[model samples]
Target: MADFFPEEELLAAIDLGSNSFHLAIARLDHGEVRKVASMSEKVQLAAGLDADKVLSLEAQQRGLDCLSRFVGRLGSVTPQRMRIVATNALREATNAQEFIDKAQRILPKSIEIIAGREEARLIYLGVSHTTAAGGRRLVVDIGGGSTEFIIGQDFEPLQTESLQMGCVAYTRQFFLDGQINPMSFERAKAAARKEVTAIAAIYRETGWDTVVGSSGTIKAARQLLMQQGLTDEQGHITYAALEKLREQILKWKHTDDIYFEGLKEDRKAVLPAGLAILMGLFEILGIEKMGYSDGALREGVMYDLLGRFRHEDVRDRSVQALMARYYADPRQAERVALTARTLFEQVADALKLDEEDGDLLRRAAYLHEIGLAISHGSYHRHGAYLLEHSDVPGFSKVDQLRLSFLVGLHRRKLRVETRAQVLHAGGQSLLTLCLLLRLSVLFHHSRYDQVVPTFVLSIIDEKTWQLAVDQHGAEWPMLQADLQQEIVQFANWGIELDIVQLIKAEIEA
Candidate 1:
């Protein structure tokens, strides 16, 4: 993990957890991140989950209230630089979009609800950066609603897993009765172990140089252990210390009553489940001792964000890697991109499309055919399918869906189903972009060794878009037919499509 970005920009990461919301602000100093400020609010978002996995009104308000305060602290981050990641709570919620829409309106940045495995990767990255970089390490981060485990050598993560075990969620399941007993403790520990069982064999095989832990739960546990004379000054969490802590926790008969030294009141109820999960991880993976790191997901996100500004963007690399892995046609894709961009410029003034659209259109054109790897039969459709299904690193699900839908609908006969998917994934703007992409693909469909048709396209009114095509040596009946087909297809997108031929004498008016 060489530092990928220049050290000029200030970076920040906000992790919206189920039990807590955190902000970590730091500046890149030499080759390391030096923290400027940090804050956490125990929002208990996971416990606020109702029977249907919907965040309760109280929980929603709590999150909103926290963001309102955080918005002030955000100060100067552009939407692109600041990353707001929601973990398991929004992943499980049916109405996450509702909350997301509200949050986006309040804040400058878009919120990314990452998958569990991605969360694990970032946790490892952050922990590795803050801890010693030598040797392979097993890192565990138990949060409010999910637990992440990773085995990484130096900075590169080898195995990543996220389990449905967390302090807040487990506390709600077992300790909500407020009458924790030996049976409840056993049940919580057993449940956590069951989740960890899925990855035990692989991680055991991969092994680790040491075991490390992070996050509030682990931090609290380390303090309690040291204060109780269970661990050393370096915060190496050992199996013996874990068992001793378990015994002490069981003696209380309730998480509330287990008041060991250095325990905070807010962490009192949730600490036992976190400890149980950590203990289960240690026993399952056969760990001797583990260190701790203050760095976790947020720190990793800040570094990643800075990478984008400094032109070391992981998203761009991920895209290029995916294209290579799928054996996509670079030359042909470039041709299409160039043609699409030419058309984009012609329409930019008329359509009022900004630089953002130009960038998006170019990317969509580059990846318009990745699904060919799956099958040549309707390869465009296949490419769309792969994009929507595969977890291309650095991409959110929504971004993949939109890109895939654009590629999927770029060709073939348009239908209502296509329109619905475009609308669902991207709404009205997506539908318009899909129209633009289809036109570009159609213009370059022949993929002739010659240059694609240069064209001017403009939105004439709220419902009408017109394309004026420049002659390419000779009139192309194939392209003309494609254009006629597009008129019908554009109707599906609720746009009136017009095609007009251009000659040198006629200024394409």
Candidate 2:
């Protein structure tokens, strides 16, 4: 079995959803992904959240156990070839790190908690790749904890939004007693309507030609509707069919008594809330009929991983978009990026850094000046705040936080707070990248077309570095002074910087 599949050809994705955990394993077949194995378990992680937003221990255990089983099935899929993303449940959990820390012990890879909009983007990518391409399309995914709405053409998402309304969440809110009555349904539909209202005007303004739904709720709803002849053979859920489904749902006084030929036992409990949310969307967004797609978050994640492997990374495009939006100085950014890369290559091995570290450093260099768009005063702080808060499409939450830390500390004094933040972001490796970026920026302080003097940087030890310039100290007094100031800053962070200049006499001798 090991010899049958090459490691590089196998890719895996795990979606730690609010209601269920899903694992999808695919094989690269002629540039397309072919599913080899897939599994899903209803953990209902969001249902375990308390009013204060802490994930309960039992829920965490359930999630961990499910992950353990999924890991056992991930045969020969290397860590680099796999991606695991957690959606709304973990995003809102106050103690999400507590669960993540425990889950990491059972799984080989770390779990990334993606932003809501990013989640929307991935869902669109999954759907676009699997479904036929048409004009602008509206894709809706209803999960256990949140629902993502995206409008996109082809493989690119034009607009994406994720709302805090989902099957499990709404079940807890409007159907906690498991009662299936018109009053409860009305309240749930009203809540969903209100949430959809926030984005309706703009969505209507930028309309889609076809509407499609993905993930568990929509799939189960479509199946049940098709089985009952409520919809056509194509499995389209029309408003009329949805209305019929609602009437039948209200027939049962409670969720436990609800039964449908195609609906799974686990899906029955949340079906009413899911139906209410869908009906509200149909009315508010004027969606007459919607089609279901098997492709979802896990599938999207696998496609995204494939893109990275092919060097078609969406992150590079996202970074470029951010730079353009903030009116960054392209030449200056290029200068810093080039110099940072040069320094990284020289010291990467000594610092135990990898290609990922180098990539992060280069990106940080390009965006280090983004804060200048808002104000010149403490612009680094402004840039940090923006990166940390912005909905960058392809970056995970940790990726944003790490980028924020590097950009924030690129210039200013390395304060005590800086040390703590560096530790939290990436530790010694991140601090080293920050230093390289700082020097790169300092070298380009003039920001002119003239080239800076050549310099050599070497690591003396873990705590010390040596920089040798090709010209005498007197040739560039400003640069010399800047270096001295940098020495003090480096000292604050427990790093020693030694400067050396090559005089003409020494070169001649």
Candidate 3:
């Protein structure tokens, strides 16, 4: 990783979308991104998923090959600066880890598979940043495996949703084998309408001043409409225009037989399914017209990356919101968080814990006791459940899981098997964080205001840790007992936790 990434240095975001893979590289100029290069390829990852929710080997290879090409274009940008996000395709795949492991070998950065709601939030962020912002706007992004619907104002999304009806998935379901006809289109629209109907009532009640569409399907429809003179000078998609396009689509006998002036060959197969989804959305939401925005997930990710560098990280805000909502003991939470940071600083390099890992530890430390708000009995489990399930903005699903794992293990006897499952890919690094958090919690068991002890934390090796407490014996007998139990706890995870108290050392000497 580069030690210093200048403001003018390039930043990149790769969206491993279900239908297509997209890469965007840009430089931050005066807090805004100036695009240097962008690439998109039809990977159709969603089409590769089987009935068992396993991604086919062929599909994984397509995605990996596309990423290999993208990695070639990402010149000089450090992996730390690039954000790679995977969407519904990977999220639904039971064997996504196999694909992710393969992808990581080829790409410079690890792939983050975001929850659907998080995807919606990022999509809204990108659209809001690029388009004019004022009144409440509804944003819709139709991707290969899923569609996201968001309503927000001035960069904050009030209501965000991700529906399972996506273009490529629907294309396979309703328009397989290149068949194109009125009946097929109607079947596709009816299926889409059924899906949208569930959320229509709520979204309609909370409506928008302007409706905007993002990503490939919407863009293709808007461009084709403009070329056909169905849209006005502004190139907005109207219901009447969509209906005409639907008619043109039904006239075609097969996907290849369909021809529009601006339609790309890659989009032809999935266009009808996309059109069906759009028509369903328009009817259900009562949308008369919608404008298009070039900004979507990739752009949103770039802006989010820029925000992290600018110290406006949304994850921090999310943690704060979680603490407040859970009515956490702020004083105790702060004490643990501070102590956790102290311990992390001592072992960060030794354990290969980066700043990101430190952030995860601190957040997990602050939120660890949140379960007390629910019940003191197994509060850690309660806290873990809350963090794991909540729609926390800016946190990817994996991020939440890691935090949950730490909070879940903060106080109790270590469940080695469970921790291994939760932090499988992370391995020792996450286990090390969990142990550090456990120690921090044990040290602050009293939860009263007190000066943190001056302690020397030394790593004897990867599996052993030594903590030299400054205080003499009987100065903190309660903490001494807790430390003794912690040794047994650490032993459960195959790590040695040795506590060195000043009084014991003096007596031995």
Q: What's model 3's TM-score? A: 0.96
Judge candidate 1 at residue 343 and give its lDDT.
75
Q: Model 3: per-residue lDDT, tens digit, 360-441?
A: 8999988998998899999999999999899898988888888888998888688667656756846678888888899888
Residue-level lDDT tens digits of model 1 in 1-509: 23355466567889999889998877779968888888889998898888899877788888999988888877864555578888999888888888888888887777888878778877887888888786888888999999999899987788988889899998988887566677777788888878888988988888777778899888888888888888877768788998888888778866668686667788988977788778777777777888889889988777666655566766667678878989988877888888787777776776667765676677888898888888889998888888777766566667777788788888888887767867776676677677778887887776766855656677788799878776554546788888888898788767888887766665534
lDDT of 1 at 478: 81
Model 3, residue 333: what's the lDDT? 90
lDDT of 2 by residue, 1-509 (tens): 12133434789999999999999999988777889999999999999999999999999999999999999998678887899999999999999999998998988887999999999999999999899987999999999999999999999899999999999999999998788789999999999999999999999999999999998888988888888888877778999988898999999999989988766888989999999999999999999889888889998999888887777788888999999999999999998899898888878888888888998999999999999999999999999999999999889999999899889999879986678778866777888888989998888888876767777788999899988777643336778879999999999988899999855664454
What TM-score does prediction 2 earn? 0.96
How much is the lDDT of residue 421 in candidate 3?
Answer: 75
How big is the positional error of residue 341 in model 3, measured in Å on the Cα after superposition? 1.0
> Which candidate tops lDDT?
2
